[model samples]
Target: MNPLTRFLSELQEVSLLIWRAFISIFSYPRYYAETIKQMDLIGVGSLPIVLLTGFFTGGVLVLQVFPTLQYYSIQNEAGNSVATSLIRELGPVLSALMVSGRIGAAISAELGSMVVSQQIDAMRALGTDPIRRLVLPRIFSLVVMLPLLTVACDILGLIGGGVVASSIYNQDYHVFATSVRVGISTSDLVSGLIKPLFFGLIIGAVACHKGLSTTGGTAGVGRSTTDAVVIASIWVIIFDFFLSKALQYLLDLGQL
Candidate 1:
């Protein structure tokens, strides 16, 4: 197929996969054990990297922007700027990107391996719906976990920025905290919190779809894993922009 046709086909497949996962949840088919396992693997296992990424990102941002703010004699508002940026954008975007790289690659590789080895086919033969057994749990786990991870990341990012602002810039920590507290509004939280839900669904859908479609052999598994991460990362960024715009519009209308 041509590139355009291939792209459309892949998009349809991803939408169907997401649809199945969502519909499967309403069946009350509990995959509690699998879901919990995924939550632990994708959420708990990802904290260290997420925390580190947030800390350095916020700190570096402060380092870069502090001079500009200081030049304007409004260095005290550095916390406000940093907090707004982190909560409204960096926290969710960075956290999703990190988790996508880690979780997305792993999911694709694992399911691709299953396909190559015919384990998934065997499950089908045994009357198992892989959508329920595999995809639903992953989708649900990601939807729940990404928001929590984003919140944690935002908090750590603020702390890291606070540290840099207080020590390197000689800004008082209490003052920084107060500024951050005042700067973050309900709209910021709503905008930030909502992005992760779509991001998680998109990541899970992309990764799972890629895995289930793997061809060749081990080489194909590698390709699928790489594709899953890159595509999921791209989708996360693309959606983030639109979500930001939509959220801002709704907030401006006082609807959210």
Candidate 2:
């Protein structure tokens, strides 16, 4: 098949998988236990790394911006810049990327292994819907947990930025806090939170699709895991750009 044809075929497959998973979410014999387990794994298991990422990102932003602001004698504005950037863009984007790298790879590997082992086939043979049992819980867990993770990252990022500004830069805590208050609006917070939901969906769908499509053998599982990470990461960035524009447009409409 031509490249375009292959791409279209893959896209169709992924879309169908997402649709099936979505429908399975409301099916009888819901996998509540599995969903909760996945939530804990994806959310709680990811917390330490997420926190570290957010803290360092925030600190680095302050470090990078402080000197420039200082030169302009607007050092106090660092908090506003940091807060607005983190809350509106960096926090969600970075957090999602981190999760895509960590969780996406794991999901793909697990599912890919199951496929390679014929475990998924066996489940189907036993009249168990793998889509409902396995895929739905994962997608739902991510959809629910990603927003919460983003929020945590945002908070840690702000705190990290505040610490750097106050201690390392000798900027007053009150000034930093005031700048953040002035810079961040409800829209910024809402937009940050909103972006991660779509990101989670993308990560889950792409990862699951790659996993389910695994062939060959162990090598294929490895390839699927790697592809899942790369594709999900790329999609996160691509979707973030469009989502930002869409959210801005909606916010503008709300003002009208």
Candidate 3:
């Protein structure tokens, strides 16, 4: 097939997946309940990793950039750059990637196991829709959890950056705070939050797709889980680039 046709066919599959989930959502209250459960599992359960990753990411980012700022005689602007980058990009994307490594793998493993064990078939036999009962909840949970997790990451990451800047670099905390306050805007924060929401959806959907397609047996579950994480991470990076570019363009256009 031509590349154009192949692309269109893949696009159609994605649209159909979204459409099926969208239509099924209206008829399924239980799916929402499962979403809440999954929120705790996917969100609350992943908090430690998220927190640890964010803290280190922020500290490292500040450390790496601090020397550049000092060399440029812009040491005073360290906090502004850190805060702007974290709130506008790093916080959400880093947190999402971290969570995807943890939660995404588990989600795929669980669902793939169900498929392998015929539990999904049992659900079908019982007149329950696996997509609604299983996949939808996960998708919804991810969408909700990722943004909240990003907020936590932003706060924690900024604090970590402040710690490193003040303690190690001898930058004053008050100066750092003021720079952050000046540099980071509500829109910047919101943009970070927005990107992660889509990131969450992609992670969950990709995980579900891999799980639902699992073959073989126990080994298949493991493979599918790994594949889910790999696919989700790649898609997250791709989406982040596009989202960043799109947002930057819109912001520039708006300024005009």
* Clash count of each predicted structure: 0, 0, 0
lDDT of 1 by residue, 1-256 (tens): 9999999999999999988888888886578999999999999999999999989888987898899988998888888888989998999999999999999999999999999999999999998899999999998889899999999999999999999998898889998898888888988898889999999999999999999999999999999999999999999999988888888788762232
How much is the lDDT of residue 248 in candidate 1?
A: 79
Ranking by TM-score: 1, 2, 3
- lDDT for each of the candidates? 0.92, 0.92, 0.85
Clashing pairs in 1: none
Q: List the residue pairs that clash in candidate 2.
A: none
Please, what are the lDDT tens digits per residue for candidate 2 over residues 67-157?
A: 9999999998999899888988999999899999999999999999999999999999999999999999998899999999999998899
Which pairs in model 3 have colliding backbones? none
List candidate 1 segments past 4 Å from native: 253-256
Poorest 10 consecutive residues by lDDT, candidate 2: 247-256
Query: Would you estimate the TM-scores of all the predictions?
Result: 0.97, 0.97, 0.92
lDDT of 3 by residue, 29-140 (tens): 5665677889999889988888887788788878999999999898888878888888778888888898889888988999999999999999999999888888888888
* RMSD to native, candidate 2: 1.8
